[model samples]
Target: MSIRKLAVLLVLGGMAAIPALAHGPHSLESMAMPGATKTTSSSRATVSPAQLKPGKPQAMLIFVRDGRGRPVERFALQHEKLMHLIVVSDDLTFFDHLHPQYVGGGRFRVTANLPASGSYTAFADYLPQGGSPQVSALHLQAGSGSTASVPLTPDSPLSKRAGDLTVTLKLDSGSIAPGRQTPLTFFIKDGNGNPVTDLQPYLGAMGHLVVIRQSPVLTAADYLHAHPEDQGGHSMGAMAEMHHTHGERQQMAGMDQMAASQKAEPGSVSFKTVFPGPGTYRLWAQFQRNGKIITADYTIAV
Candidate 1:
């Protein structure tokens, strides 16, 4: 399923308000870093996602290494942990933050039971020798009924390198008018100019894009309204109808709920959202591949 199709199903299913459930042995405290370094090592890591039986627990393996492609020590002191594994579904549901147990050496393993079959993204965040922190996004297909193996090769279209991913914002018109619904599409591609297909779920969705209005005039009242009665989980109406005009900031509402309703199915993932107020907005999309995590940022005027 395409990302857009997945988004439509999630909205129509009335399951947007559900919060993603976290399972496993690792805690956020163990993965926290006291400080981040500006430089990262040159080593290239690799990650692979194998499809497991539907309704059964699934697992993803991550292999870390040094600049020479040698596996690094599991308990390396350079970073807090050798590797951090994050799983997200296409629809932004089924988010899991797990610390894969290092099975000796540099191999890490995480156990996950995909609720259903679909395209999911697995991100590996780690520190390389003599380098700062690096992230990579990898695509995995579950329950597709096709036993064909999708290799994570350096030349694969779905596998984007550290410096190749980019996102561009385009509006239907030259400018967006207030109180009007506008269409926004994010054009994403790798450095080699390939469309990202196997977009795996990361943190419970095909991918996570955070958009924050830059104006101080944009407040919660102006962006999001309390949907105490919105049982259907459609919070866009409340946010778009906010009364405040300017000078307030609010995190996009309904993320936790949207993250919870994720179910695994086949295909790409997508969704639609409207900005409550008009201003310069910053959007961030995070994904992982090749045992590394990559975040792409874009600024747009709405």
Candidate 2:
């Protein structure tokens, strides 16, 4: 069967099995993009530290398979490329939108050089057979070191622009230790100083946050992380429960319809993130408004 058809079956199977599975770590939503109806599965797939090595350019391999665990080769309703892989670190430091060169037997491999020792998140975007595009997050740990505990002043101004949007970086506590959950907030408003409630879902979430360990040059070796934080200004912990909300369901449906119809938007969207370590890091937030795709980036020291 075609990859698209197989993808449809996989999605249906996942939905049917949802009740039998424990509550996942993340939620899924529709990110409305022109020519693509993107749905993201918040459940994070983890790659053990043993499977990853630090201080070297490592190759992360991914296989696109059906519910039956068979490889998927064609999609896009017309047997287009089977997958589009986007890799980002936890701190929003590295961003790579890669179309992996397909390796034989349904496996895709890309060279990723991790810069530091930390956790990273990988997003795989693909079309399941006869269904809308879907995104899944995978977590991989690299290197060896404790996360920094220095505290960031809450509501500290980081940067600003003329678009009436101001960006700030803050931490839940004055100090954070390794393996501990720290809350990071990104407050956004229009020129009117009101919360931008109409914040459309970008890349299957209210927003996409990519964090990378700072290096002289960007490399997969630099620690990379990617995640979809909660939409209501909460920390990432609540991400799992977000899927069942009415707003998320409506947004998912809207994204599928929008993609099926193929519409484009204008402008850019931006946000902020926090790193687990004391080193420098970079962030990229992607969003859509008025049919325009907006990408803003920033670099910060933790």
Candidate 3:
């Protein structure tokens, strides 16, 4: 099953059937990537002060290494960054997308500002220079108390308000079943309920989706990340080719004008992905409008 190509709305016959049991490191999407290596890389994140307070910022250092315990120095750019770090509280109420700065020696550094004292999960999503995409789940403890929290429940309505925009999400299939590639579409409207047509290019794409299943202890197997399908119906390889041939600056410039030129449906974007298993999942959809990034979240059962 290849995820390198975008599936047309009318043609779903060739979509990949991702296994319900496969996720994180063993996700078929990453395994099917071009030039994926058998030897996987590893990463570990350590937070300073060990114990965190309710409203203070803490320094986080992540070290990437090979399977042989050697530091992996080189990394490939994905989504305009070397690493994409996603953090969420155990209760699923807090979510943050952070990009750690590479400080050499296979180390990346960032500051984490956890709102309350509890257990948090940090998912490190990255690509080694010569390896496949990797996801490493790290643990962070705050305040050294019982790690108990409220149970996660599915959202009643799929619609949410982010700033002045109202976003509603819909799934192509009536019910989202495990092991099936489902197209998740989002529609945006302004405060006055008119469809919003002017969305900016964010992180080289129309939008980004990050999902994590509710679990006692979150791991790489419980995480998934996706991007909006290319409007031009181009494969991932073709997109990469355009990125390199024209350079990041040029490619981004071209993408900035794509919304106006394509004349696509007003305020609608879709992403096709597979749910590894049946569980309650929290999803965060991020987009940019008028140069400000907005995040809207939803909870759903598979």
Model 1 ranges with Cα > 4 A deviation: 1-49, 74-80, 145-302
Looking at model 3, the pairs that clash are none
Where in model 3 is the C-alpha error above 4 Å? 1-50, 173-175, 232-263
The alpha-carbon lDDT assigned to residue 203 of candidate 3 equals 69
Question: Scored by Cα lDDT, where does model 1 land?
Answer: 0.39
lDDT tens per residue, model 3, 1-302: 11111110100112221211236676422432211111112222223323456688766666665534455777777778788889888778899999988777777777878787777767777766655667766555566554565667777778999998999998654657898877788899999999888887776777889988987667678898877666555433345445434445534633743643255567887777789999889999999889999899998888
lDDT of each: 0.39, 0.43, 0.66
Candidate 1, residues 95-181, lDDT tens digits: the string is 454566666545566676666776554445454333333444433446774222222122112222336665444445544665564
Top-scoring candidate (lDDT): 3
Q: How close is candidate 2 to the true structure, as a TM-score?
A: 0.40
Work out the TM-score per prediction.
0.34, 0.40, 0.78
Off by over 4 Å in 2: 1-156, 162-164, 215-277
Name the lDDT value of residue 18 in candidate 3: 20
Candidate 3 or 1, higher TM-score: 3
For residue 298, what is the lDDT in candidate 1?
48
